[model samples]
Target: MPFLRNAWYVAAWSSDVSQTEPLQRTLLGESIVLYRDSLGRPVALANRCPHRFAPMDGGRVRGDALECPYHGLRFDRTGRCVHNPHGDGRIPAAARVASYEVEERYGAVWIWMGEPERVAVTPLPAFDYLDPQENETSTGYLLTRANFQLSADNLLDLSHFQFLHPDTLGSNQMASGTMTFDEVGETVWSRRVCRGEQLQEFVANAYGVPPGMAVDRWLNVRWDVPGLMSIEVGVAPSGIPREFGRMSYSGHFLTPETETSTHYFFAFGLPKAMGEAARTLVEYAVDGLMTPFKEEDLPMLEAQQCALGDQDFWQARPVLLSIDGAAIRARRIMDRKIATEQLEQQARIEQCEAEQGGKTPMPELTAVPIDCSALAR
Candidate 1:
């Protein structure tokens, strides 16, 4: 599975990277080291040192630079080697590592893994609800030994909740809900609304609803490019407006670590306007909601991966279902974007080669763009 490289991927929670120690993580199959500079800004660089190809994470931070453990070579935030403790103290021009564009926002450190020039045009997806100052938030991470798309598919289709998370997050009414799919700009949305259903105990407690009370429940998920999703779940008294009821918003950001593994970064947040009581509910939401995901979803996704084993998802010939519409739409959107990017990259390479008097001339690429206007909302 070719990844969409020209995009922002969450490398880690802002709290995960520190000024004292380098945090190493694999994103899009590349080893990256993240740390804060002396001025308290995050920096991301290739984890391997050019000299001897040693891992740079083993080194210690010295001011705004990282001192290589294998040798005393020091690299600054821009990935340029500032000092070479070896003979003559003359730093080789090729001693530096690749410096990645990084931005800290929405409580996470986002890294751009594609062309540095493209970073100016590409904007990070806004996740304002995750701001800690305005919302009571809880974050959790889990490494899944499954393809990132598979995990994303699980979220796009909520029907599985009825069977996979019966006790914690699902109910019989959920499967019978009316589902609708649409597109808003570049975002794909999947919405399920279950009316006149008995509130599950876990949900009732989170929303402070009376147990067993029949309410209108909604599960709305919006997906952006490169596996970023925001899920809005709420329940309200029958025939009542949703704003008058309790709602919780959660962000599910998935970054592929490899073809067969993913880095799942998820966070739950509730408006502080819901009062101090909402803070307590946010804690319960984390513990109560994460139970099914950690115990049930994780195992199922991993087992599914083991079953597929190096085979492409479509090659496995999955049976089609109405519930799979949203996931399939997203998969197609991703496919088109990746294909377009690859073509553009090839065109650039060929143009460069042609400039150098290569035999092959640069071919004009007529890539097909994704048309979502028909489904636009």
Candidate 2:
């Protein structure tokens, strides 16, 4: 569970947090409560109260601060204890929770679980296509009982779709499709093209393809660090240029809840130029196709997790196939990044201890940003 803490991870959708109540979610194994302040800006803080260790989510939002349900101590947006109804109303210096940096964009609230200083430089993975003003978008969340990497692998290597989702999103053409993998800086790209085949009924309808028509279908996926992916799927008449085809864009943002669970946020979008009919088609695909596909994927992922219980993924010695190239590359990249961060952190701690003449208190970690501008697709 050595997460790339310097990167941004989706905490909740914009619609999930409101000014009236706090939303509790666990990310990177830490309990975080999210709520909007008086001005309707999102706020994220450690969920545990400093006094009685009560969860802040159980308390009510009082303007820009959250009132502790246990003893009525109030914590402000900066996580400072501003109101103490106890004896003398004197707040202890330690009566504050850790506040995390958060940003609201592309209809999701992203949290930085790592060093605060790096937040300014580590820009969020570009997802401008998800802006509602430019495109018709629908989002959904699924809590999968599986490692975030496992869920990520599922998206990176889509060969499983032919077998795992034959009825909705797959076909024999998928296995025979031409696939390629490439890396441009920190981003990983996987592309597949199937020629002269009819897509699944719902998929064809979503792309405005006529029944029984043979088309060239393409699936292209781009992966950013720490499990952010954008997928483009399109279909064109056999011999036509892909630019003239019907296409849809989707995003998959994975945030680990723990070593064995992940918070999956996904969105499907179509250009507003496609009109209301395309919007309705996207909604239908979400409800009719994606919903059922989730039903199929979750159980399989959970079963895989149960099988690998307590054992590391590499320690389990999974057999790799040609289809696994993209997934394996992504795993190696993430592993290297996490290892580097850990080493830098240890060095800083050692330097601090040496300067203090003993093992004194450790100072805040200052992380160097990992530039992912090349990963923006």
Candidate 3:
């Protein structure tokens, strides 16, 4: 899969990894294992052990070290082999595994599957709603069998809501409203404003009004490169200012597991002032949003993937739609970024060759393929 290698991708929720339980997941086609160390700091490493290529997640955590289940070899958070129960306690020079830079913030564990130097300066997408003081949010995770970009495309284009989520999120306003698309730097956003229209029943409930009430509503969605989208939705009495209305920020964070799968993390957040009653309503709203996703979206996306077979997305030349502007912009941004990275990597390789008198230097290995059948024997 051609992915943005220099970007931060979510590995798992902070609550998903623990000192006792290790999380095994694939990111950008790399197998990653995550767990909190003895000191409660999250650690991400290549899931395979060097000795016999056993899965590190099959082992147990002892102190800050991960012990291999195959032969009891142990490795620490830095991916250095710390203990070897055999061979006179002498560890092999090449016994270490790969370790990824990890950051635990915004209620998720983010893994930098890129160059370590880039990880320090790479800014993560702001999820202010996940902050404890500003708002309360209900989060859910969905594992889907579709490329991450497909999910992003689904999100950036809201026109499909009329048909896909007819009962909960769709309305005549979404179909008839004038939509505007804009791109600023690496961000692409789309806005739709409807005046004096009957809001969707789900939106009306969240707005603390009757289901059929006519109101002014705004649906503003922003898309950042790679996989971050934030949607702001608000509704109020016609001609009333937004400050006096009910609003929510719905966040979507998509992380690619492979070319064919994704880890989708979503949050529906409302202000703290909403109180307990509003919280209950938000829960209902979340369920309402999830229904179309699980029942309608997932199956459709899976079928789309099946139809594509092994063909790349752009290779298929998808039919352009009026609502696809934002999604297309996002795809272009990502494509340019990926192309730039490929050029940079080739330059580094050429530079290494020049420095070494036209000989290719030994590249650092991030992972090794082992024959599981041999290990079984």
Worst 10-residue lDDT window for candidate 3 reads 367-376
Q: Would you list the C-alpha lDDT of every candidate in the order shown?
A: 0.86, 0.87, 0.81
lDDT for residue 294 in candidate 2, whole number 0-100: 74
TM-score of 3: 0.91
TM-score of each model, paired residue for residue = 0.93, 0.94, 0.91
Best by TM-score: 2
Question: Which of candidates 1 and 3 reaches a greater lDDT?
Answer: 1
Per-residue lDDT tens digits of candidate 3, residues 1-377?
A: 57787887778877799999778998888888888889999999899998789998988988898888899998888999999999799999989999988998777888887788776777987878776466667777898899888899888877777788777777776777778999999999988887777767766777787866778888888988689889988888889997898777787889998898889988777677768864676577678778788998888788888888889889998999788889999999999998888777666655555655655434533222222233223
Would you list the rank order by TM-score, best first?
2, 1, 3
Which has the better lDDT: candidate 2, or candidate 3?
A: 2
Candidate 3: stretches off by over 4 Å: 359-377
Writing each residue's lDDT as its tens digit, candidate 2 over 1-377 gives: 56788999999999999999899999998899999999999999999999889999999999999998998999998899999997899989989998989999988999997888888888877877798878888888899999999998999877787899888888888888999999887899999998997778878877788899999999999999999999999899999999999878889999999999999999887778878975796677567755655789988999999999999999999998899888888999999998999889878667655655666554444453333331221
Instruction: Enumerate clash totals for all models, in the order shown.
Output: 0, 0, 0
Least accurate 10 contiguous residues by lDDT in model 2 = 368-377
